[model samples]
Target: MQGDTKLKVGILTFHRTTNYGAVLQTYALQKTILDLGYDVKVIDYNNEEIYSYCDYRVLYGKLPLKTRVGKIIRYSHNKKIAKTFNKFRNKWIDLSVECNTNAQLQSVEDGYDAIICGSDQVWNPLAIHFDFDAFLLSGVKGKRISYAASAGNITLWEKYLKKYWICLHRFDSISVRESEMIQPVENLSEKKVRLVLDPTLLLNKKEWEKLEEPLGNEIEKDNYILVYYLGKNRALTDTVKKLQKQTGLPVVLLGRQIEGIKSISVPAGPSQFLSLFHHAKFVITSSFHGTVFSILYHKPFLVFGNGNYNSRMNTLLSALKLQSRMIDNESANLERINKVVDWGQVDSLHKALKEKSINFLIEALR
Candidate 1:
């Protein structure tokens, strides 16, 4: 417990999420804030919709009747995987008292000195949980700030512009993760929005390394290409095959199980996810976090873009000067994938971004 003198901070983000990026980013932001001498807690605001996304039972019920059997089979196979993810959350995250509704969030408002809203796509309308004003610290008193909050897309829908514009005004300061989103947010809120690094990047590579406890000997010793495709890009399947042929290595697909590939049916928790990235000879992925860890670990990786959904990845690669690492459907070719990334230069850029982002957090909190 913190003494009375230390400021009590409540953070609002996707803390209960099972996703590797969401969990680690939440941890990074909390750790960073604690390092700054404040007592921090991730506001335990559990959105039923977001939580349902991870629950196979809820998911199976939503699927078509014809697909129910397959869904059940998949869910049964992933029970342990889900348990691993839940254990990570229960073990590592420091959560505040549970707040289910806006009223509940406001009820606990008096306990905090200030409230922080992000380090993720907490402003994204597509994220049903954040679409409402709760993550904006609505009804809360005192300082309200967003730290590296992401809109997650290049543009916001016209319908939400006015609503977001009004809600964003509550923030004393605004910092967005995507560089392309700064002006759009500024135009909406008429507030100066700063571009900052993702929370995971704010904490250096070594800091993340400490979180990775070995997942037994299940991890293969042989060098292999790690495939983590979160999008429905069939072309990526071919690309993975080509990479396997060229590299003369086996392919290990993380996340969902693929028929032809050596897919790990288990859902990889945060630590296991890190282990996969750390041990991989190379990575080919469509997920934002997949690309992030590849860079964090200084691994040579290729990103498969998902059209407009690829905007966040584009912004990250552009900012770090690693655009060549990305390959889209239009530009898909062996030549691009075979190209090399200069990790030495990338590391320098990451350091600069890390410092700038951390400085923004410190200043915003002060």
Candidate 2:
């Protein structure tokens, strides 16, 4: 508590996840709250599912290619990614003692003056299964505020409507990441919901630059297109090939070793991830944070959407007036990929959105 000994906040987020976006957003949110003079700790909720997302051993069993050699290669790369992300989590994130079960979370809930869950797909049912109830903080004796929490896809199924309605009403303040999510949440919960920016946007480029400076010019010396695809989108690979053919620039796939595509063998930490975005000649991604860092670095980028994951990307692109940058299976041609973006206008809109998101946090915290 920097100011008047305010609330000790515990942020329950995707901080433990191996995804670059998840870790970065968790850091941003924690930093923002700390800057506001509140004590904060990223609650380290232990769940095997969180670690399994990037684990090659788990994915290896699912992969169609069952050769021992192929399994070993995938396993090693996945371990590298997991190790790198774990290192980042340890260095940048201040975490509480691990809590794996509902009983553990319940026992520790009262330790916080307030609990914040946010800035990621924590509410996305597809990714989180067991801890959904824990995130609700049912037994916690503190203010429950959700900041920029996403519902993943906008189409909320009726099956979970009652559960969400109950959880949404329990929060002291609720803010969703997407505009479309606000309406559905408001409708289901029968409560006012604020639309907020992703937590990563809270910190400026200069703040992120400090982290990148240490990583040096490893990625900067050469011109390359950065491809960060999180989903199994077959068309995205074809699109990347098309981009390579059109531009003649080498494509660097981060944390993913796609067939026939050049990729960084080791998983990159947060700083290294930012450096890749900073030095990229162009960026193409399916992940929301990939588009975010591209915009932060002022790099020319294209966003592609797949399956239920399209809503968040669509909402973000539409808001920033960069809808033209979103391409799909049919429209992902050379000309469409080459479409220019007006960064000046996008920056202006981003500034306003950032302010709104901050205001919501301030009001909720107060």
Candidate 3:
């Protein structure tokens, strides 16, 4: 796709996920690669050997065990959400359906000009339990590129250090979404890692404007607050309720499972998501993608990170100087939450980030 070569590009991501940030980032990366004219495909990690142990018990149920000699059929492992995710994700790209063994992935190297392992925490070793093999980053034989991939926290892990070093050493180019992670990545392999924006930021407000068939400005005419949660923390939930009681505006929630006093329970797609930001009086969310769309639409929002989990939100928010907008759900002030953010300035920053990111992608892919 770059030249006369039809880029049989395969991307590795945590795609069988319901996470909004994960899904949107995948969509952004695929669209970016497609816009570059590459023939792309997305592959998911799967292993079906588990739950068979429990199934063999006579009390609950029994599975057909052809252990004498047979193929390890993995398709039966992923069902419901996994199947649904693949159903929708496969629509975007020609899905990879042939690989069942490590040998298959190795053979796959012959099909593509390059493979990108990116846009999410793909390199995180913790993924092996959920997928067949997560070190797919190390499996590619052609040109390898990793973009905006975070190894969760950049701290030392003796087990992963060697593989991390090897993968980074072998890549043609590497970039991270978080600035704080640049040092750790370099320390691991001495690779000069570029600080690139997330793939979601590659497109501007105008580009997003085209994808979303605009919702009529009917509901947006009234004032309401938007809330999204990523925290398992209870304090964050209490704050959302308190804010709504005091402000007396209806709260429309997204990306959370908690019951709301005055809220609508619906998955927010691009248009509804955009509308939430386009018209919200204010926002309070603990999710990273919630903050992303808020900033994209120039809406003032409060962000809370998971303290137990090492979240990359702090580094990103600091870079944008939106640290003031981030509310520590543990200790929050209702008075300050009411303060409005300057939509004009946020719009300018998003514009600059989008422009810089688009230019970088065009240059890097070349």
Which is better, 1 or 2, measured by lDDT? 2
Q: Note the clash tally of each candidate.
A: 0, 0, 2
Candidate 2 wrongly placed segments (more than 4 Å): 53-68, 154-157, 213-222, 260-266, 335-339
Compare the candidates by TM-score and give the number of the best one: 1
Q: Rate the local accuracy (lDDT) of all candidates.
A: 0.78, 0.79, 0.64
For all predicted structures, in order, the TM-scores are 0.91, 0.90, 0.78
Winner by lDDT: 2
Q: In model 3, what are the clashing residue pairs, if there are any?
A: 1-5, 1-7
Write one digit per residue (lDDT tens) for candidate 1, span 115-227: 89887778777775544668766677867888988766646546676678787877788998877788888887788888888788777778888888664455574377888
Give one digit per residue, the lDDT tens place, for model 3 in 1-366.
Answer: 374566677776655564556766777887887777777776544343311222323332343466311223322332323444444455543556655456676577557767777777766555444342334456777777777877665553456677677667877777777777788878876877777777777765666665543444434534887877764656667777888888888777665456556676444454445556666787788777777777776665778766633356776676677788776657467766757666667667766766666555555566
Where does candidate 2 clash, by residue pair?
none
Which segments of candidate 1 are over 4 A away from where they belong? 1-5, 54-66, 129-131, 216-218, 264-266, 330-338
In model 3, where do residues sit more than 4 Å from their true spots? 1-6, 44-94, 98-100, 128-136, 209-223, 255-262, 267-279, 308-311, 329-331
Question: 1 or 3, which is superior by lDDT?
Answer: 1
